[model samples]
Target: MRLGQRLRTIADMVPIGVTMADIGTDHAYLPIYLVEQKIITSAIAGDIHQGPYLSAKNAVAAVQLTQHISVRLGNGLEVVKPGEAEVVVIAGMGGANIIDILNSRPEVTSKVKRLILQPMIAAALVRTWLHTQGWQIVDEQLVQEEGKLYQIIAAEPGGSPVVEPVLYEIGPLLWQSKHPLLKLHINELIGHLRGVILAMEGSADAVKLAKYREYTIRLKALEEKIRCL
Candidate 1:
């Protein structure tokens, strides 16, 4: 039941003593581990793909947790019923897919008490969606697993009005708390933006030029903010 750093980070974000549904659950490792540790009472492991669904089913049976964990073969929140789980975890997928899942089943999602999301790409998009859709990014974690950085967001059903652009680009909690990895992540983003700006310098495309200037301006602001930090 050993969870990798990425999955472990997501697992750590789950509140204790609440039933959960793990969407896109490949092998049901997180649910199995949580149940074994007594961190959760029961879980639903849902996977869209047949191979992974069967794999998860076998994994759950191997551990003799058939009664505690329900392994279902369905896409996104379709497998999750309203009030079935207080928390829903969607991990190991792109941010767009996570957003789609949430949007596809707002009826079920609205009733969910918490959402733990780990977006492999386009994390900012996920944050933006959360903000605009009435969910709050309550907590966030940045983890570099096997040399690749991953962002995990934990959200609840409510939030106050927020500034979209800033919260979307930089996590609300991460920016305010100044997490230990914030500086590192900012530096990496700055470097990447700088490279993009440079590549766009020789281009005559108006769109590219506009984006280049925008990124350059943002780069300077982020640099200055980092200096203050």
Candidate 2:
């Protein structure tokens, strides 16, 4: 099965011959591809909504992978039991929501060998959560699809904390490796911060002013990072 650039990047991070669980699996594409390629022995494709649950069921059936892949309708990691899967994949969601899912089931998440996360926004939160939880970022990938850029983070147990605040926003590994998309990502972030600053210009509200100053500081950091890049 052919996967999109974003999903393909996430899939590539999965280790060979492991049991995987994919949360919010839109159509079970990722699991199906991995199972078919023999990358994973089996998988649990889960989604909170019924439509996606049925869609995943049908997709797995169409490919005659019913025995290898189980489609379940549930929220977050609730679909799988502890020690059921070696790798857990959460993609195409906001950073906060992803963290909630992980936080929701510590038992399930704690047993997992690895986490492959793709946060749609506020990736810094996700990175911070991982660091605080002692999950070291093993690898990071940046991919652009349909004019939007996505960050894929792969983490495992026993990682060090990220000391620099800006490094959390710009992935430490991505910065160290100088990913081809790093400069573009930084530019995009700078653009977003600039837009926020411009929108809050002249606002006297204490909360707004405080936020404005925060954005200004972050914007300057990003600008400095870009210059070095």
Candidate 3:
């Protein structure tokens, strides 16, 4: 099975020989690819919608991996039990939604060895929550697919005791190591903030002015960080 750049990157992050539960698995492509490559011995492909659930079921059957991949119809991580999977992957969802899913069943998540998250937006929130929950973000990858930039985060148990706001905004691992894509991503963010600042230039509202000032300061800080890199 051919996986897209985004899914392929996420799949590469999964450790070999570990069972994984792919939550909200739209087409079950990731699990199917992993099993076919013998990267993971087994996987549980779970989905909340019937359409995707049936699609996943059919996909697994077509691949002749019925015994290795279990197609489950459920919401979030509710389909799997503790100790059933070593890793849990929740991708293609918003950061807030991912946090809610993890929060829904702490018992199951607490037992898992690692979590691979691919938040569609508000990724900073996911990072912040991970830090607070004691899940250390071990690695991150940034990829541009079809003109859109995507961020993938891998976290495990035992995180840092401190969760800085800047770390959440800039990504601790990505910023500290200065990943190749970090400068580009930061430049994009600076552009966005500049646009916001420009939009708020003529506003008389105190709130808008306050936000403009804040964004200006953030833009300068991001530029300085990029320069240092």
Candidate 4:
């Protein structure tokens, strides 16, 4: 099972030595890769749906990693207890869904040393919610996979946080680190912004125009922020 470079990079970013859990483990690839590489001693491949759970179970079995990898069918961290895992990886989901999983259980949140999040979309919402909850993004990575750019953020609880308004749009680490691909992604977003503003033209409703006008302003401000970047 060859994981793509982007997903493989996310797997690489996992703490070199620790027990971790992969939530919504569709094919259980991350865990299998980590354990096979001996980076992690054990992992819990958990998912909310039966299809993914069974797929993960079958994969784990085929790899003969059943002992090192446990496949459980459960939602979020409801199946994980505190102090069991030091690292958690949640990927291929929306930011809001990840936030919901984090907010759903305090016990799981309190025990982890790191959270590796690779949201498919709504990353800004996830980053904002994490900042509001006092989590610090320690590091991040940017990669273009299958024509779409994705950001992978690793965060931990505690310490002073700095979340600028524009941080949500471009990500604090991406802005601070100035990851090269970030510029390209921002450029793409600016193009989208232009198209959105163009689409809003000829709308007669005052409320609709007002709402879009506000969004346009926000987009322009975001454009300026990127320009500065």
Q: Score every model by TM-score.
A: 0.91, 0.97, 0.90, 0.91
Q: Model 3, range 100-122, lDDT digits (tens) per residue?
A: 99999988998899899999888
Query: Could you tell me how far off, in angstroms, the CA of residue 76 lies in candidate 3 after the best superposition?
Result: 0.7
Q: Give the residue spans of candidate 1 off by over 4 A.
A: 206-210
Q: Per-residue lDDT for 74 in model 4?
A: 98
lDDT of 4 by residue, 157-202 (tens): 8764666666786788888888989889778767876777777775
What is the lDDT, from 0 to 100, of the residue 224 in candidate 3? 79
Ranking, TM-score, top scorer first? 2, 4, 1, 3
At residue 133, what lDDT does model 1 achieve?
86
Q: For model 1, what is the alpha-carbon lDDT of residue 19?
A: 96
Could you give candidate 1's per-residue lDDT for residues 1-229 as a string of tens digits? Answer: 9988999999898899999999999999999999999999999999999999999999999999999999999989999898899999999899899999999998888889999998887787898888788888888998888887777899998864766364466677888888888888778777877787777776678445667667777788768767867
For lDDT, the strongest prediction is 2
- Tens digit per residue, CA lDDT, model 2, 1-229: 9999999999999999999999999899999999999999999999999998999999999999999999999999999999999999999999999999999999999999999999999999999999999899999999999999999999999968546788899999999999999999999898888888887775667436667778888888888889997
TM-score of 3: 0.90
Consecutive 10-residue window with the lowest summed lDDT within model 2: 202-211
